[model samples]
Target: MLQSLQSVAFAEISLAGDLISANRGFYVLLQLAPDSVVDHVGPYINNPSFTELAAGAQRAMPGQVVYQGLITFLGELGEPRSLLARVCRQGDHLAMIAEHDVRENENLLAAVMDLNEELAEQQRALARANRQLAAEKAEQQRLLQELATAQAHLVQSAQLVSLGQLAAGVAHEINNPISFVRANVATLGGYVGDLLAIIDAYAAGEALLAQDPSLLARIHRLRERCDLDFVRGDAVAVVAESAAGIARVARIVSDLKNFARINESEWQVADLHACLESTLNVASHELRGSAEVVRQYGPLPALHCCPGQLNQVFMNLLLNAIQSLEGAGNGPGRIFLRTGRQDDQGWIEIEDNGRGIGPERLPRIFEPFYTTRAIGAGTGLGLSSAWGIINAHGGRIEVRTEVGKGSTFRIWLPLSRTTSE
Candidate 1:
């Protein structure tokens, strides 16, 4: 409401006679510029000095009239003008209202018109400043987003480096023992077969020595005590099972090495099916009791991509599917992996029968540090990193999800590397 009365010549002055603030009308009456610095009221008053006004205000109570009379004001051109003034005590300050005489009304009106034009120009300047500030703010936001993306990439690189080192170490440490044990199991199996043949030969000789019934009875008792028949059959089965177990361990280590791809950092034309298999094998422990995987693999050609990075993507998606199933209630959890080639692109789809994403959260699922999982359960960068890697490979990812049912993520990559890549 006070801002609406711009034409009123009102001023607030301190007890020490310093000019506090004034409206456009006051500046116009004094013939001063709109943004002029009027430090003291003493220099502007020609009739009564500000000292006399302060003394008068000190004698009156707050909200009481201090001085009511004509005051002579000195304009910028040193022209003295007399105007009717009323001063009131307002708390620690003095409020003054001044009005020009009837004969000087025309001059006051002209000055007011000039003040309005100056005010309009100032407003325009303020508006331009606001626009510039807004643009600068938007630029800052863009830079921050770029910084976040760069940080996420750095984190993913570090993780991959660590994984590669670990995989290399495990493969080296486990492969030697696996090879020795495998060979030992094969030799032991042959030794057991020869021992069983000797036992059978001894049994036949016992029949030949039937002339000594006591010797035959003693041999029968010894065989029964040792459970020779059961041992003969179980021994070969145990050795075979041990060899198979050793082979499975070797396969797992190989799969881990393949999934890590420590030595294959550069782009290559590789089998996508092999990559998927390696990833599945690497995450076998996590999927064992949680979710059953179903594969619907189609004929796909070798795709030009970073095998390690694609493996990382597959790992992330597979782990998320497994976790989702774990969180789903006591129903059977299933994950479907599908791959196919369409035109020049090959697509891999991972779908889960677990709790799905809601509408509000679907859009930001790939945003870094945005997660629906409980704190410490996830880093929230899995999907974001996957998205970044696919984009870097000149590929794209699509998501299809429904609440309470499940979610499907399909990654589409070009069969051949593009020139831009």
Candidate 2:
């Protein structure tokens, strides 16, 4: 039986998991020495079932097959090798018979390797796609922010243009009536003086009237009935007051005309103080009910700028100051307007004693569409547009405030237009 097992390809192991013997074919397959085969089965077999294989070898009867299956093992080069293997009992020993199944194994390994490569490629593609999507998301966010700013600018510019047109119309329509009324009051003042002189002459002729006592009595009765002394004094005073009032109206209309010149769309030599005065007149209604405005004028050089745009900036600033006071409700508010020149630059300051901005919110005031007011009450583009206009004019605006105290906005403009522009 041993000779027959040796003729076939076979190996024998003891119950203690030691290699007892092996045929010439088995030795050739595993590249093992026949003399060193004993107790060396672990070096050649790759599976962790050697102890169970040894036990099966001891329990099987003669000529009975103990196990039959495909198995893997390590060859002389330490590379994986597969075989069709079987174990059978022969007396007290078990013989393992095996043959290489190379063709079937090669086909199975190629299919598994192709599937793994495909899975790796899929994961790499997914990673690249994720990176691209992240970049696109970032770009979209930037574009959205830019669009919001542009929209706010457009709306603010439209509002300023409309206001300019309205002011121009008002100034034009009221100019004629205001002129005539002013002139009539001036003429009436002279006429009242002449009539009072005539009444005086009649009084001086009282002595001559003694020649006709009846005529003198008639004149005395008429003077007593009409109260001529009071009429003469009151008529002069009334004409003077009317003239002063008309003068004030004319001044207001003139300011309106100046404020509306922003529609010219060209730069001109501008008086900053004059612009401030005009803006104050235009904003008088808002200020009168809420605060007292104090003007501190200074000698400032003329600026080469777009007067209308500067007037718009002044309007926004004044409105903001007035509204701040209106919200405080701590009694009447105070607004201070100061103008000065330093280092050939002109500066105007609009300071208010009202509710001040909190520190956290102060930084974002100039951002487009950012407002602290209720949603429908404010459009939030005033400061943003103001800042843009100032920047284009080569100027800057500075702000200082303390919570519960007040706020001050200072604007400095270039004395001359940039030659490049």
CA lDDT, every model vs. true structure: 0.83, 0.79
Please name the candidate that would achieve the greatest TM-score relative to the true structure.
Answer: 1
| Cα-based TM-score, every candidate | 0.68, 0.63
lDDT of 2 at 43: 68
Write candidate 2's Cα lDDT for 108-141 as tens digits: 3344345445655776798899999999999999
> Candidate 2 — which residues are off by over 4 angstroms?
1-137, 201-227, 327-332, 419-421
What is the Cα-based lDDT of residue 117 in candidate 2?
59
Give candidate 2's error at residue 268 in angstroms.
1.5
**Candidate 1: count of backbone clashes, pairs at least 3 residues apart or interchain:** 0
* Candidate 1 residue lDDT tens string, 261-299: 833568877898999999998899898888889999998
Q: 170 in model 2: Cα distance from truth in Å?
A: 0.4
Off by over 4 Å in 1: 1-143, 207-222, 419-421
Specify the highest-lDDT model's number: 1
| Residue 144 Cα positional deviation in candidate 1, in Å, after optimal superposition | 3.7
Error of 1 at 300 (Å): 1.2
